[model samples]
Target chain A: MPESTFLDSTELVLNMGPQHPSTHGVLRVILKLDGEKVLGTDCVIGYLHRGVEKIAENRTYAQFNPYVDRMDYVAAISNGLGYCLAIEKLLNVEAPPRAQAVRVILTELNRIASHLVWLGTHALDIGAITPVFYCFREREEALKIFENYCGARLTTHAFRIGGLQYETYDGFEKEVLAFCDMFLPKVDEYEELLTNNRIWAGRLKHVGVLNAEECKEYGVTGPVLRAAGVKWDLRKAQPYSGYQQYDFEIPTCENGDTYDRYTVRIEEMRQSARIMRQAVEKLAAGPIMAKVPKVIKPPVGEVYVSIEAPKGELGYYVVSDGTTQPYRVRVRPPSFVNLQALGRMVAGGLVADVVAIIGTLDIVLGEVDR
Target chain B: MADEQKPAGSPSPAPSGAGGVNPKAGPAAGAPKTAPPKPAAAAPPKPPAIMAATPWDSELARDLRDRFPDQIGETSTYLGQDFLIAKPDAIISILEYLKLEADFDYLVDITAVDWPKKPERFELVYILYSFAHNRRVRVKTSIADGYRPASAVGVHLTANWLEREVYDMFGIEFAGHPDLRRILLPEEWQGFPLRKEYSIVQQDERWVRENLGIESGQ
Candidate 1:
């Protein structure tokens, strides 16, 4: 080896996106690169910051339910469930059995839909176009159930404080069962298309490996943590919204690489289908709403309620001042926290792998920049 | 005691200031008190139910108190969830103790609540989860306006952006943060958006005008 000169080994600064097709949203990552290998990355977010926490302080508890859906717009039901559960816990009331069952079914379906979107876009990011089409076809079936039940497709305010806002529509359970039966086989079909294909595995395998310790250090959760063989799923760790009743397995992998994360997500979709089927069978005949007050003023208290969303542990920290409006509402969006580890995962990797790493993280800009 | 003081302190001028009822019309005004106030309502105002429900003698609370005397202020529960209030200076040490000894390894979130009227204006909350114990606990500390609490980055790397976000939202900085710039807002933004006085509609108008070269719509 010869002595290196300053001009021979210089780093170049490249701006990826404030608005680019592959970024999925307006996430601008400034990259410092030596040729193609990335040295460092700095994310410039907040293009979509709507000051949602500030808005929650002004809105009443019941009035603020819709805003939570807009945060993680892909998994709208999980967001709604977390917000409603936090308010319900603050009010010291439990949703009726029927309401809890319906909530579990809807949220599981939303989890499938969210992962489908992740699968489609993630594969698309790695230049696999066929899986995006196949994944969206299944995702459309899930969204159809959402639209038929709540009259909204994307940001469905499906649940109210202490219960569901709408009763299960006619043939709701039947449609959900049919979608689960149809969606599981599609998961296998996706596997056949890209799971072991040489090109797909070549791009994603051993790319952006964040181990269990690094994941715990960065507070990363969801499939990213599970793929590190942590086996820590919030639904199983701390059950809420009647999740204790459901039977499902937390799929984990040992490698903690991008490919392992993909395989873990695929297995998770199958497990979500299993949970939905069990939830529908447990749906009993009873009142869908609880005995909540019309005024909806919770006592002076605070509660932190977290749910296993598609992305990770979505938390709502609510403080009530014994008034109609809340004193403060802090949302612990998993995407925002998990996005912090992007620099850690992408550094010392090729520039092309940055897209793969971002894709595997499955971050939603709506939640990250909320 | 609270009810007796209410009738003794302000009833003299309250009745006259409230409406046109006069001294001669006392019987007409007082006739609506047929149903007496309940005994439960007669008690002094409660402090958030959490302050009353949680016993200070839990095993975990006792262990923390034994280790850090006078540093553990309140070990309270709300809806079967435990939270500890710690002295601001002892926050980092308590967090390290919880992680190393008590098995609270996961730093779930770091956020602050702004109380404009309280002498300690910023209430910092660190939500933690212990996978080994299968439990979640919150560690909180109160700080004045300009006091910077120790950053948890040394203990958990997750605190880097979480502290930056708290600083961006509430203007509560953390001491020894590696990169403590605004995470959510722009670098040149003026007021903290999550403070009590900062309304939802308010923006850094100069930031908008200078960056976009247009008047802010709001």
Candidate 2:
């Protein structure tokens, strides 16, 4: 007591990840703590770096499409969609209306699937355990739809630069319609489990509150931005791949808190179903692949095309130097940008809230490190 | 079934199969026919009187050139995205102006392209998006090997990790970056992996040998 200085000596340093389950992946957060309260946080990422940008420079444009799936493994189809659309833009080729419609169907299904994983894991992180199983139980159906469309369930390289590599499977439309029918109710069930739960609301209501302006400053996007009451979904903002044709609303929540993010994502899943139904209902009679040259050599230029990926604005910046290989392919991963807000979100929150904040951010470490 | 599983190289099926929707239905009713147009500003950005002689096309670009005529280089458009080339010294100032004046608040991405043969070998790319204007512009600048590009973290906080990533991959330093440490690679790891001259297989071999103590079967 006699030796007490102005600064608190009781502040402790806590390392919260690189292996901890609550971190979502290998995201390590170095937390400066004062008892249970977090004073500062430095997120140490790159534990899962596979040198994707380097890999893109080495591989041919077509060869690199598969690797894009590895970045955001939870939403691999969305990754494929963004990559193909960017390359298509660079190559100055357009996927046909039928192909575009099919692409939207697959991507929206994947978006639902991605949000399901987020809702499940986020609720579990907040201590509501039952929702995880319920989320997965429903998520399995979306994965099955992907499996039917493409052989791979996870990391399905489901799109090509010009169009879809594989045509819609024989029962693909029926299966997607089935998923659309099944998933809408499951979202409600998940909400029922966590939306009003005392533990869930108490843990999340006021925790990790990042206002809309702070979100913009930090470059946070996707559900987190929408949660902050910004109706800035890239799909609606800059409609890519015929997203303009689909009717849907960008779900936004006030308060920018963890609960807000939760509600936003939940609404998004329902909206994704609406988009899928429209796309599948009008599943047209045409080819899935666009006509292009045998060897894909885009002109010497760069193009940045972004999509409203489930997590956020997933943009692919492709620079082609009149070569089969890309001169540079920069992936503007939403999670990577969104993760910048974590320090601001966690600064004044409790140590336990760090997990909820991390979960609320819905970061996939593969995308972060890539 | 075997035909369905065939890979991409084979002759693709014609696009006019029984797969598409009703052509007669047209696009779904009530869907917006077009995306929202670029947000209209009340008055077009006034060209800075300093560089009135310069042939700057866009209002924002002209304003940037007028403010820092020395730093502003050539401006071009690639596939609808605008590119504003800025000298290394002028990047932060130009970015600050864009953030404050032009409303390019969202710093979308920061990356670099390697050109081993060129004298100014590294072309750093900064993509910025403005929610207000609903527009995107790419700011690019080239730096010679070993030249440090000023970090945009001071102008935009999001540039912190992005600059770290560029530094990690290309081995280019950003002056004034708060934490200029390797982000994607181990601290002890040697050599920049994304440069044009760096051999991927060789780097992998060396990294595995040094870090994991195992022979990389390359």
Candidate 3:
């Protein structure tokens, strides 16, 4: 009689999102389930598509600067940094030393802020309610630093093609130092809240296991790649904007599971804080903007520039036809690439673990759809 | 075309003036003496500073030319990065060889450019990165309008979404792509948005009217 009952069970098809809170923005994953075990999954994206690449072609080089801010709104500074670097490379000029140092400081701070948002929302997704508040408390300080520098909080276009558009606020160093002093203890507080919590570990460890090889195949990067035991970080791999000057260890974990990703991000926050401290100490005093032409026109060629964004390797491929407007601008968004591994990570796992897997991926649909 | 004309235009009088100052000035003021025929051959023609050194010592370019001579067209360097122009149909084999033998295990990105005036209209660019060497090279090949380049899914699994995106934005199909649906646009959407002929001011009027219940403002 029990075997007959098992034989009679029909598989259930579940549509998880396009509006679901845990799906992380408008991502819809269709999961084929047989009694809580997932057989197949297809991720449906592009819900927030704004056609950014198409828009890039229409706008002049300078005109398109602000648009990069809307993609990966959490790490707006990183997007701006990557786009600016690509354009600067096309123009065959480098940002002044002071500007590069300031860029490194602001971008690393943005990395921390972006990761804090990820920690908060990802914890919120997995039902750990308290860490979200602690995360915001730290993230608000980082945003305050940006507001002081750029006047905009969420979508801060902090850097220009040649250098920083706005000079540092009077006490930029002091304020950043104050933040670093407060941020380290707050990181400790976050770890205490969720790092070893039995419920947190139960939900995260071994929940979604993706190995290093699978990560490579799917073009996954950032903390996920590090979590899968690959010691690859673009900051270290290809030192850009004076990352080579800072001495900080890249964190990696061997498990390639949800817990490893969590640990990797937490350690990365600590390293980011370390880099910020070193940057502030070595922050030279000089001009912020370089000798850039007023009418920004890059030569006729194509260049791809990538930076170590908080989520992963954020690359901007710019093709110029000796014109003010780019012939083509392609953004290799980390969230979009990492989202490719969702199906691989979720297969054969319980339906309930799907939320944990999605949170582990830490996708911002703004970047995915852009 | 532009590069060849530059040297021809600039270097004509350099050898003549130098020789005129030393030996050939005997005929210089007199018209026929201005031509420094002997020194021109004696100088052996020094290359311009820009072309003095082959910017990137790209071993991959050499290997590609050696292995698949027919597929490799020309390798050019811009800003110290090598761009290998490959034959359109030979993209799959070139990429596979690079991935397997050359240790370019990572597919960083795949994108395309639209040249409206050119006969081979679409420029498909494949950006590949080698972890072992910590180097990046771009493989570029051109295709005409509506021609499908071979899919790179067989070379890199990450190409699945990238090829779909290329197809969605540029309307240049990937011949062997498993799922080549419109990625960023609706399935019922009309035209490729990234083409030079495609203006951003234009939109699918019917879809906009039906889906959002609003006029597209023309």
Candidate 4:
């Protein structure tokens, strides 16, 4: 004990839920707060960790496809496509042209759907509720198209080892065309609701500013990097699965803020739609599967293949020792890498702005935890 | 012996002893006198070695090898691409050189592969990219049981999670990683599941029996 008098001090710590609605999915963030100003924040994840990579090692190449879909359930098709492309490269097998075109179509549609969820939830997180309904209205249509192709809506798992497991549905073109016609106007409606609104602009502009240099140094890609004025799109820079044959633009923003990220994703929705339309137009008559042997025992080597996933560069690093099962399968999940910048972005901002920034990043906790 | 008797640049050999002349000669060459044979119509040059372009193709790897000649080991060209298998101790040094002198700027990924049969149990693969040069380089170093490669966390912040992941799966320690805790797996997890010697059946049975209520030995 001190000889003289001593004053007592204490700090308050709050456990934001592993169950809270806004935590997204079983994510417990330990926030050291001083009246809505975060002194420090530590994210405690793994409640949802299922040891996906370990599971992948035990499973064969084909059996692992459905499991990856569960990693980023919001954009399952992209996850499936990334894994398929990596396995294909390892096998040294090329997907037929028609299959590549269909893969592109479905992945872009999934991108639109994934962005819709982001837009809807981000808008909802910031007190605007109507756009969620609007987003769902369009998302339902996209899910219908997915269901038509793979008999499943959310986790289509449409892709396979060498190519697609099956061809596109008979009327897939008409459904996608109809969706595109309606999706563009719906994107305009979302822009009308939030893009120029003073309240929305005030909340997001210049908030959580991550510059272009920082974005690249941190390996932040997809809309987040494009939002920071770096025009490094995997689809354009390193195209996969016939993405090069399609026509689209990679949108970028000069200001690297939450607003910039929002604008970039919105524009990306339109671009994804454009790519989908082009894919549908280019759909030709051909075989879907390459002449792959039944037992897919790729040579003993490792290959890393990445695709322009909805969130960012979703890469799959597969090592095969001429075995049915991979020696090691590492998924370079974009959400997990992108979420690393969370602490930096939300460091000194207000707690409300922290939620906005998180929403702006549009992370799906499934992928993060996996 | 008949094949060996043909001249160096002759299009077709004459049937022996036909005045040592090629039978298929064109009109311009038919009346040719012995004017030193006009240098035999200068033969086309042979193709260059495919491996020659490998070093030039990846400026980042080439520059690093040049800058740190002693530290960087022999560069191997595989499929017309260069890969440097450096000594384990020189990994961090090369990474620092790559970031500071070469401006690699991005550490794309840090992964490890288990080659159990080899003397080196693990191959730690670090793929670095230079946006300025628009080229990528795969830097690898062998990790044995008692030895661990130096971590590149100081050079690239992106390696923090990746190194942890490699440690998590492969159990190849990154010597100076700040937080080398298990990333994708829980702390109490028993073994490095990715190792070939690790028994997957035991883990599978344990998981299935404990988590999913499925009985073992099924």
Task: Give the winner by lDDT.
Answer: 1
Cα lDDT listed for each candidate: 0.85, 0.81, 0.83, 0.77
- How far off is each candidate at the interface, as Cα RMSD in Å? 12.1, 13.5, 16.4, 20.0
DockQ of 1: 0.22
Q: How are the candidates ranked when ordered by DockQ, highest leading?
A: 1, 2, 3, 4
Q: For the second chain of model 2, what is the TM-score against the true structure's chain B?
A: 0.73
Task: Write the residue-wise lDDT of candidate 3 on B1-218 in tens digits.
Answer: 11121111111333433333233211111112122233323321332323211334567777788998988778778888887888998889988898889888889899988888889989999998888889889998999997878889988999999989999888998998999999878899998888878778888999999998998845
Candidate 3, residues A57-127, lDDT tens digits: the string is 87667667778999999999999999999998987888888889899999989999999988998999889
Best by TM-score: 1
List DockQ, one per candidate, in order: 0.22, 0.21, 0.17, 0.09
Which of candidates 1 and 2 is the stronger one according to DockQ? 1
Cα lDDT of candidate 3 equals 0.83
Report how large a share of the reference interface contacts model 1 reproduces: 0.44
Inter-residue clash pairs, candidate 4: none
Task: Give per-residue CA lDDT, model 1, range A2-119, as digits (tens).
Answer: 2344567777899999887778788999999888888899999988888889988886676677888999999999999999899889878899999999999889899999999999
| TM-score, chain B, predicted structure 4 | 0.65
Candidate 1 lDDT for residue A110: 93
lDDT of 2 at A331: 94
How far out, in Å, is residue B188 in model 1? 0.6
